[model samples]
Structure formats: structure tokens, C-alpha cells
Target chain A: MKRWIPFILTLALLVPIGAEAAIVVVVNNANPTEKMSERELIDMYMGRNLYFANGQLALRLDHSPKSSVRRDFYRQLVGKTVAQVNAYWARLLFTGTAAPPHVIPDKSEVIEAVKKNVNAIGYIDEADLVEDLKVVGRID
Target chain B: MFSSIHTPLRWLICGSCLVLMAWFISPGLVNAQVINDNDFKVSGFLTLGATRGGDEFLGFRRFVSQEGVFEDEWSYKTDSVIGVQFDKKFTSNWAATVQLVGRERIKNSFKESIDWAFLKYRINPNLTARAGRIGMSIYMLSDYRNVGFAYLWARPPTDFYSLIAFDYYDGADIVFNAPLGSGTFKAKFLVGSSENKFRFNDSAAEFKLNNMFGASLLWENQTWRFRYGFLSFDFDDSINQVLGTDLVADAFELADAFGWDGADNTADDIRAEGESALYHALGFVYEKLPWTIQGEISYLDTDYDVIKSNITRYISVGYIFDEITVYGMLGKGSQTSSRTKLPDLPDSLSSIPLAVQLRDGAQLLYNASYADQESIAAGARWDLRYDIALKMQLDHIRVEENGTVYWASDTLPDKDRAINIVSINLNYIF
Candidate 1:
């Protein structure tokens, strides 16, 4: 009875909040490269691996700070918390080491940042990719 | 010998002109995109911390002297520190930075200070040059000794960092960075000399101090980095010369009191002298995936006229999870010098046959040696919130040396052999 009650409650809670779901991923409309493996994509976004599949410098873009999309992006791609990422950068920056990639504020901001730069790539909700923005691949 | 005066006035004037040029050229000239938006501004950071040695002697050793004296009770104060760094980015190609640090009295009562300044001129996207006061890059973690956030713990291994206190020199560095297929490459070449005053020990008739000149090369690629450097210093005649004379006179007095055959003569002939130091250091770091490890080995060869050489090595390892990291470290070493005397002989017996002298002293006089000290530290870092972390560390240290004890009845109390320290800190960076 208790399990049934919790299951019913969960359904009740989720049914009304049928929020939009988005498959976020990066894409290149003009480049010859067609697809990226999950590892390659995660490497590019997490600031760990910087080179593209073709060995070219991969310029990356991001959702704005504190954005839900950004949080989801990292949770799905980096598998680490914001605090861990901050600590990672702390270790890197203070050691006279490398700095992380530049951060753009929002989906629109990222879309604009990536659109203007040829080597750029970033994530946004699947629904957000209109006719202008191309969909290279879906995450998961 | 320290009073070498140069054209300080000329340097100051040149600095003023550079500032004026920066102000006059609003940067719309080079990139045209950069403006005096005041949005582009400079920020700085500073920190101050102090510690009191425990009732039992605590803290850094008296390095100037080779002798170890345990203080019954001593309250120590250090500038601990206050510093300011001004960071300016004029264009995508030009950036300038200035750092000034004030240290507490290094000498008995005189303060010490160093001005660390740099002007970085970016050549292309992968290379740059920096000129000004630059500290040597010993370890990847050694360069930013002041920027506390670099490490997960309160401090990096103190044994290595503390041994060669001054790591920076005034010079120019050329740094290059490039990306390999899956990793990044970083290289730095630096050369410079130090213009500063440092104090080592408080006792000893043969104290040593010197001015240092050196160069270091560092290379880092993704998960691994290596550093190798050589440094040489010219030491001036020591303040111990007078102390050595006094010891000789005292020896003569003691020999007469002891009714020794050479009652009229003293062992002043055995007074050991001081010498300069030339040293080399090699360090390595590997951080791939969830594990990070760092190790450094250094060899310090003092021209102490006599005795065997001294070499020290330090190693540490760390592992990181989402927000927590645990680390362990081990450091053990010793310094050997003929000047070190055995402690057992009467204060008057300044010299004797080497074999007899070795037995008479309780690791005192020319047995002038530091206990082979060893320590094992384990610590964890917890990130409680954004920008702040709570850290707790425990360290157990062991010191091997000859010390004294008062006979209470017939029982022997274990003198100073083991020490335990626990520290908790909240660190934050903005």
C-alpha cells in the first residue's frame, strides 16, 4: 500500500509538469565533419580535450552562467558538479597553467557566439534549433 | 657586501613612463575594439595569516645556525604577509601585471620585501614574453606559492618549499604553448638573479648566507610536466667569524679549568668555516584522470670546505573525487658538515682527534647534524559551498636527535621525539 501510494504520488506530481524535453548537442553545418562520438563531445565541452576529430583547434561555446541548459549540459557531458569544475579550474589557473574555454551567457548568446565563429560549437535544446541552426547529433 | 646600489631612480622613472604610455594609448589604436569602458578594469588579491609556536617549540627551524635549540616557550611573529597584484589586459595582444609583497622581519628586526612585476607581450596566439621579478619554476605547483587556491590542502609540502625559501629572481621569461593531437604543450624558459636579504640561523659560529643567480626550464604537456634547474650563490664572509673567535677563547679557558695536559692551549684550530651553496633540483608531475602525483628531488652541495654532501627529496600523491580529495606525503633527509660538532664533550673541548671527538659528543659539535626528520601527512578537502571549502589535515612528525632531560627521581620521561598537528581552515576565492 505504501509503495502504491508513493508511485501514485510520483505520477500525480509528474503528470501535471509535462515540461518540454530537449536533446542538446553540437552541430556543424558547413564543416565536412558530420558527427562526434560521445567521448569526443564530452572532451570538447568539459575543457579537457581541445582538439577536434580532425586535429584542428576546436573552439567551443557554452550556455550562460547559472543557466538550466548549462547545468544540464555539464551534468550530461562532464559528469561532475559545478564545484568540481571550479576546483579543477582553480588547480589549473593558479599553477600558471591553462585557463578554461570562454563562457557565453545563454542559448541565444551561445547560438550567436558559435554562429559567428567557424570553428565554434555549443549546445541548446533540440527544439531551439530552427531552420537557421543545424542539428548535428543528439546527446543520448 | 649586500649594499650594492644601482640606479633605482632610473628604473622608477622608466616605470612612470610605461604607466603614462598605458594611460595615453587608450587601446583603440591596436585592436580598435578595446575601449576605456571602465568595464575593463583591474582587480587585486591579498592575504594575511599568522601562527604562534606551541608551548613546546614549533614552526620553522633556525636555519642560519646548524644547531638545534628547543625553546621552552617562544612566541614567533612573521609578516605572514600582505600583497597586491594589479592585472591589466590592454588588448588581445598586450597584458601587464604587477605584484608587490611585504615580508615580516627576516633578519632579527629588519623587514624584507620583493616587487614582482611582469609585462607580457603576446606573440601570435601561442607564445609570450614576461620581464621583471620572476621566481624559478621548481614544480608545477611551486610557481604560485602565494596563490593558495592551487592546492587542495593548506600548503604544499613545506620541507621542499621551505628548504630553498627564495625561488624567484628578477629576469625575463619566454613561454610558449601549443596543442598536440589530444594534449597541450607548455614550455617556459626563465633566467634571473635575486636582489634580497635572507636570514637562515640564529646561532653557530659559522653561519652561512648568500646571493643567488639561476635559470630554470619547465615543460608541461597535458597529464605530465617536468622541471630542472641549477642555481649558484656567492656567500659573503659570515658573522660567525667573530663567534668562532669567541669559542676559541672560551676553549682555552675551559682547557685550563679541566686540568688537561694542554691546559695552557685551546682547540681553536678546529673551528670550522662557512661556504656558499650551489644546488640543482628536478621535479615531475603527472595528473591524468582521477589521480594526480607530484615528486621533487633536490641536491644541495655546500662548499663547506669539509664533510660529506647533503641531498633531500620530497614526494606526495593525491586522488580526487567529485568534491573531495585525499592526499599523502613522505619526506626524509639529512645535512652533513664537518663543522657539525658532537654534543657530549664539555663546551670547552673545541677540538680533539676525530675518532675521540666523535665519541665524546652527544651528536653535538662537528657532529653538527640535524636529526634525520620524517613526517607523514594525510588530509582531505571538502567543498561545502561555492567559492569556499572546509579542510582538515593531520600530520605526525618524528625527529631524531640528541636532547636533554631532567632526572625526576629515577624515571626517564620520553623527551621530544614525536609531534602531532591538526589544522582546519575555510578557504575562499573570488
Candidate 2:
């Protein structure tokens, strides 16, 4: 029973860590690209560069502004908080310079959108990722 | 009575049309998914603000009882404005955009003014050509100067931006965007002419700029950006009869009496006609997470003797803490006006009646040139909500020489003065 207690405590600690490790960036299975650098992701998401590595027009999708996943994704990918990202977008939008990514309601919709559109790219929890989507990048 | 009613009715119809269009487009926009592939998109920003000063500053009157007079008190119309924009994509490579802005200026009520109306043709992904009424890209923030939400300050430092008040020109431009190393490089060339009607000292004047041309280059990386721009324009203030009216006529009449060969031509030469100017600006911005620094310097050289050459610069630094940001800015402007020495009025002409008046007129012209001023500002911005921000700022301004920059009344003291201004604003975007 003493040995079992140690193993159970370790398992409990690893569960949340494992869950956090599941955050990843995903693209359509048909995209043909296997991976993306962090800089490329930042450019597309921030409306700086609109073309993907393959010269294909890129479409960006986001989790809802209120989502914890969205906040975590931006923090990991761009080192900006959700509020900072929102403020940045406000500058672009009000200037008629660029538009932000279309926000989806949940991780499921993000997955569905990316799966159906070859140009679409999104971020989701690895646990929610399916075989139909290609994992292009992973949040460290 | 009919004429007054007619004008208001026309404005009402225009206002209603804009509201209806916004209503129809807001839903599709709010439902982000519904407008992902739509043909039309609508967006806008609004800023409501109140400001007060310990002394008269920046032409903001403390009360409506006087015009162009400096007063010390609170005012609401200084920084409040609203803007709306609509974009429509007709084809893969064709698009059109229209933007309207309303603000309290020389008028009492909000008057809808077209800020930009342009048609765009995308020759390729990297290049675009646009024609119509386009925002002048002379300065770093010129394109979005009125959009308070886009900037960190309740207002851009007026010391430098107020040098040229025209924001748009009727003409065409071409923009090129290309990838350079890990960064992006953008170049824009514009050619346009602008006409402006402005009120100075309760007197209105019309200014027409001809053959205006400008070019700008910007290179931006993940953490840093550098920009350089140049502009040249031919200025004509011939229609501004108010300029030197009381003195110019007397000077010319005196010249004719003295049998000066170019008596009539002298007024034209000194009247700011066919005057030309060259402007150059260099600016940079560095942003890395919680730290931001931005600075710009500009130089203007003009042939108009009454309008002295000037140099202006400002630097701003800020730190972002979660949803709050605190910043400080320092700015300075200097003008070099060469005092007209009256060309050593001949001893024989010293006895003449009009000769003395002409010399006095020239002195007034030199005095009307811009003054040397310095400003320091500290401000904080808080993101109150996803689309709303609250900002409060305090500024201390000192005029070193002539204090003509703030459009003070003739009755106000023209010598050096110091003023403090406190402003608060709510900026929102949708």
C-alpha cells in the first residue's frame, strides 16, 4: 500500500502537465506542409504576411477571445497576453489596414474548419486533435 | 427659412442612410464566421473625451463666450470624434473602400465628412494601385490620425502634427509590399493636390497646394521598424486676401509712389505665391513584449520668408503591465526666422511716411512665424474591456519665443508662456 501511494501521487501530478502538453497548432491535412516556424505563425496570425510557405493564400482562425486556450496560444506563440493581442488588432482594424482572424466558438469548430479548408490554420488541444488534421507546430 | 430647412433635411437623409447601412452590416460582422468569406465588411471607432487646462493651450477654449481667446477651464469638444469605414470586395483583385468621420471643429454639430473614398486594383499579391480621395501618408500616423484607438495617447503630440493640418489629398498612389529577409518592406509613392479652408484668428483663409508629391519606405521586422519619407509641394496663397491685407496694400501703394519698378510684383513675391517647400522625416519604433520605444524627427525647408524653416522631433517610451500601460513623451520644435532688416532704408526714405509702415509690416510678418516650444507628457492607458480603453494624460508645455502656435487671440499676450493640460478619454473600437 505504501508503494501504491507514491505511484498514485506521481500520476496525479503528471495528469495536468500532460494535459497542458496537448496544446498544439494544426493545419488542414491537405496542406502538404509538415511544420511551421514560430515567426511564420506570428506573421499570419497578426495579418502581416498572408501567404503560406507553399504560396497558397492563408486563412487564419482563432479560438474565441474569451477562451483560455486563446490566451495560452498567444502567450506561447507570440509572447503577448490576450489583452495585448486585442489592442494590437484594434490598431490595425481602426486604421483600415488589416483584419483579424475569424474566431470560432470552440476547439471542435476550429478543428472542423481546418479540416474542411486547405488554406485554414488553427490551434487546438492535442487531446482534441484527430487523425484527419495535421499537426504543423506544437506549443512549448 | 426654406434654405435652412433644406440643408438640415439633406444632412438628415445622409445620416439615416449611413445608420441603416451600418445596421445591416454589424450583424454579419459580429458573427465572425458569417463574414469570413463575405463580400462586405464594416468597422468603426469612437472616442469621447473631456479636457481642462490651468492656462489656455492648444486653441482649446475654456468657454464658448469668446472665439480664438485663450481661457483656463474645462472643455469637452477638444478630443471627441467618431469614424466609420466600409469595404467591399467585388472580385478577387478589385475592391473599394469608403470611410467617413465626424468631429467637432469649427462647427457646432457633428458634420459627416468623407475621409477616404478609393478604388483599389491589386495587380498582384505584392503590389496595389489606388485612386480617388486617399489618406495622405506623409507622417507615420497620418493615415490613421483621427482613429484615437489606434494610438496610445489621448491625442498625438500636437507640437509636430499640427505643422501640416491637411490629412487627405485627391489623387492616386501605388503601394509595394515585399518580403525582405525575415522582415517585410513596404514602399509607397503618392501624387496629389489638396485645398484647405482654415480659420486663423477668427479670419478664414483658403490654401491651395499644387503638384504635391511624396514617397515613403518602411521596413518592419518582428521587433523593430524603420521608416523614411520625403515630400515636396508648391504652395499658393494668392486667394488669401486676408494675409497681410492691412499692410500689403499700404506697402504696395508706397512703392508705387516711390516709383519702385516692381511695386505690384513686390506684393506678389512676398504674398506666399509660388512658394515651395521640401519636407523630410525619419522615424523608428521598437517593440519587444512589455517594452516599447518610438521616436521621429522631421525637417521642413521653405522658400517663403515669412514661414521659417523648422525642425521637430519627439520620443516616447512606455511599459505595458498586463492590461495597463504607462508612458512618457518628450517633444521639441524650433523655427529659425530671419528678422527682416528693412534692407537699410535710405536716409532719404526714412522721412517718407509709408516707408516706416512697410518696415513695421515686415516686422509683424517675422513675428508671426512659429515659435520654439517644448513639451513633456505622462499618461496611462487601461484596457477596461475587450474593445474599450480608458486613458488620462497630463502635459506641461513651454513656449520659448513667440507663442503663435496655439492660435491665441490678438488680445492675449504674445510673449513666452507656460501651460498645463489634463485630458481624459474613453476610446473604443467595433
Q: Write the per-residue lDDT of candidate 2 for residues B219-267, one digit (tens) a residue.
A: 8876787999988898765633646543575576567567654555556
* Global lDDT scores for all candidate models: 0.51, 0.72
* Model 1 Cα shift for residue B59 (angstroms): 3.4
Question: How close is chain A of candidate 2 to the true chain A, as a TM-score?
Answer: 0.87
C-alpha lDDT of residue B428 in model 2? 74
lDDT of 1 by residue, A49-114 (tens): 555666555666655446666656656555555665665665544433333455565466666655
RMSD of 2: 4.5
Q: What DockQ do you compute for every candidate structure?
A: 0.17, 0.38
TM-score of only chain B in every candidate structure = 0.64, 0.85
